[model samples]
Target: MILHAGVLGLLVGGTVIVALMLFGSLVGVRILRTWNPMSTSEEQLILERQTYLVSVLVAVALWIEIGSALLFIHTVDDLHELFVGAMCATGTLNANPVGWWVLAAKGAIVLLFPIWLAVNGLDQRSGSFPLVRLKYGLLLVLTPLAVADLSLQIAYFGGLQPDIITSCCGALFSESSDTVTGDLAAIPAVLAFPVFLAVSLLFLAAVGWARVSPRPISRIIAAVLSPVTLAVGVVAVISFVSVAYYELPTHHCPFDLFQSGSAFVGYPLMFSLVAAVVLAAMPGALLMVTQHPALRDVAAGSERRWLTGAAAAFTIFLVVAIWPLVFGNLAWESM
Candidate 1:
């Protein structure tokens, strides 16, 4: 199983990403300590050139990090057949519990990498490069996370044993199970669906209003509601969306949506959700820099574009979630 093409790809890609980030962090530290746009000395010129190289290196590594995140899930799902009780990515992850940590690490990168890139983008838009210090500081923080991700992946793949009889998704997702996933699965669809629908609509309204109006309050509302909406959306998927997608109310394995039998619907379902969350959260994340006198005007101008993109992404998610509910034959009952 360790020799699988996808597994090899993930391991190699993770290693390269860590190396790039490590190099970038070394450069980042120097930049943090001595970066000054006003300095015209030879050392300052050298630092400027180094910053450009480090930025490109980190950007490439982060882009691969995003792709590797998705590939990690797909690889695990593909490996399920080797484990006796495995069903999907869930069971494969269960076979080697350390894989969960790998997933967590990858998820963190997925969430943070974009925010960093956005900050870098905002920094590049200015002549003075006002956000340089903040960007390098953030790179230093993220470098450790990249190292952890690789370490966890190595630990996970190294420990895999096909002989282990792991519990399948059915048991884990069933109400009889005592795990958090089980609790989410146990949520009554009738109740969960309404809450999900209400929150989704409200979030859309808030984000849409922000995009159109671009007021401080509207942006604040959208930013605040973005993560809340994503959390609720995940719960709703576990509670009922999966059920609707499968048309079997009792089958609630979210990973199964990625399989061919489901027409690979989970890709679009999750892609839109993540895109919506990331885009919607950008304005809020950028708020960290808005207080900087030099970045205030640039942040304000960029936020409008972010808001516009966020509204469109959120709409895509809403359409994808609602499509199955309306068109599919499954009708929610007590559970």
Candidate 2:
């Protein structure tokens, strides 16, 4: 099965990551927790090197996760032909409870990896590496999550039965359906569209203002932008993504976008928004590295660059998402 192939890749990648993380966690608890900055001990030197090694491995593993997420979704979309009632990736995912759990795990892994990178960045900037324990401890925590992700992938793919019929996106995401997605779909475009636009603009404006503002003010804006960006992502589903892909204002089903030509924009647009949030949120590393006054400048410089990157990413998302409505010659009707 296509899903089996995808799950196989995840298991391989996740197992390697979990092993490295376990080592890192052991070092954190037994050595790094008590190591001295001034000690010229052999153990301290080895611990430092081991830390870097774990980081390199984890970073590579995280990169694999990003690719795996896309591959998983693509495989599901491709399997629609084989699935008795699947019309797209969404339908395939709706096939069983395990499917949604797999998706949740994928989302968590993607989101967590960047935060791990931020933690590592904080440790890198600290002269004494005070956050070493925190970083390794986090790695330990994430190890279980990665394992769960692997387990969920196996369960999802294993549960898939070609003989069993499943509901398509049309039925699962329809207005009358009793799902959370259905409720979101039922939100009239009249309201959802404006809210989506307003939220996006607010996010854009806040991040822009943050670029030039003082650190405290910029941090506040960053704090607000987090939730706003999340809201924008949600509305993008029920409003922009659904409408653009389906070419029908009322057909607010996100899965439909992964079908045929619409698939071109679906994942790319979603990825762009996610990238924007990841970039914009990097300045938060400051909270972890504040012990080192020297790193304040480093944090400031990184914040500016990352927020600018966020803006650029969001701009790309806007262009890609609206292209169908403006230039793809999509048929549209008044909301």
Candidate 3:
């Protein structure tokens, strides 16, 4: 029964991601055509507008995905029961094939959209917020979030142990029994600190260099951001390590590590971290758009029209997809 439920939940979750990706790709392609002409001025405006709009859209999507993931995690036990019943009714559960193609498609879409936005957005001629700067800033602010996440993982998987005392030093020590699980499961917490620390130091160095020299500090700021940028590179390595070393080989069930009650509590932290990063970046990006010469022209005329249209279309799509779930009927009474 439990196995069946796990499979069912995985199917539903994968379906949702696939739907979102299909819609998002259509939106991306439409936006891309507007820039086919690719003039200096038009291209700059298109990129800036797209950056802000896409960031906002992704932030919204992430919030929804996190919430759904948590809910699915919490209700995993019930799902397991459902799975068992289905298998019993059908007689041959082992022959059923899981949808790996859907999973791969969804993953590609989710990852590619952000890279598309970041590359086009940052590559513009105007001296807007460098991609490096925003990346580093995100790293610094999410540090505490990372630590809290690690602690939670330790609490969840690692069983409690009695405190140990050293006879010579009279020091007490304890080890967490929390075993790491899925790659995605550990990321929000573990990566937060190092990302934050590297970025903060770079920003501080930029400020110091500015005070000491008469030259324009943007180049210095960009330079400081370069090393911190390497943190993004660490993501793949960490994810691989997490899956290879932390996850159990046989725990094919998606929700094995998720606890429903704890999900509502823990999931909110993930949303909060993402929201913080977006909120912090938005104001500066907005200010930069107004001040940067190349961007100023893009905002002036019909170019702004196309940008606004694209943003509005994307927003409408999100509203259509999310509103029903948020306000729709509940199956059970709340505690």
Best by lDDT: 1
Decreasing TM-score order of the candidates: 1, 2, 3
How does residue 28 of candidate 3 score in lDDT? 46
What is the per-residue lDDT of model 3 for residues 1-335, given as tens digits with 9 covering 90 to 100?
A: 22344434444544444444344444444444444333568765665465455444444444444443444344433433333222111111111212122222323333233333433344343445434234323323222332333233223222212131111100100012132323323444235435644554454344344334324343235333433433332332222221222233221222221234223222332223223222222222344433445554443332233223323332332243223224434221210
Please list the C-alpha lDDT of all candidates, in the order they appear.
Answer: 0.84, 0.72, 0.33
> Candidate 2, after superposition: displacement of residue 166 in Å?
0.8
- Once fitted onto the true fold, the runs of candidate 1 whose alpha carbons sit more than 4 angstroms away are 291-293
- Among all windows of 10 consecutive residues in model 1, the one with the lowest summed lDDT is 210-219
Clash totals for all models, in order?
A: 0, 0, 12
Candidate that beats the other on TM-score, 1 or 3, i.e. the better one = 1
Point out the worst 10-residue segment of candidate 3 by lDDT: 166-175
Candidate 3 lDDT for residue 162: 17
Give RMSD (Å) of candidate 2 vs. truth.
2.4
Order candidates by lDDT, high to low. Answer: 1, 2, 3
Candidate 3 residue spans exceeding 4 A from truth: 1-10, 23-64, 72-264, 278-335
Model 2 ranges off by over 4 Å: 1-4, 285-291, 328-333
Query: Where is the poorest 10-residue window by lDDT in model 2?
Result: 283-292
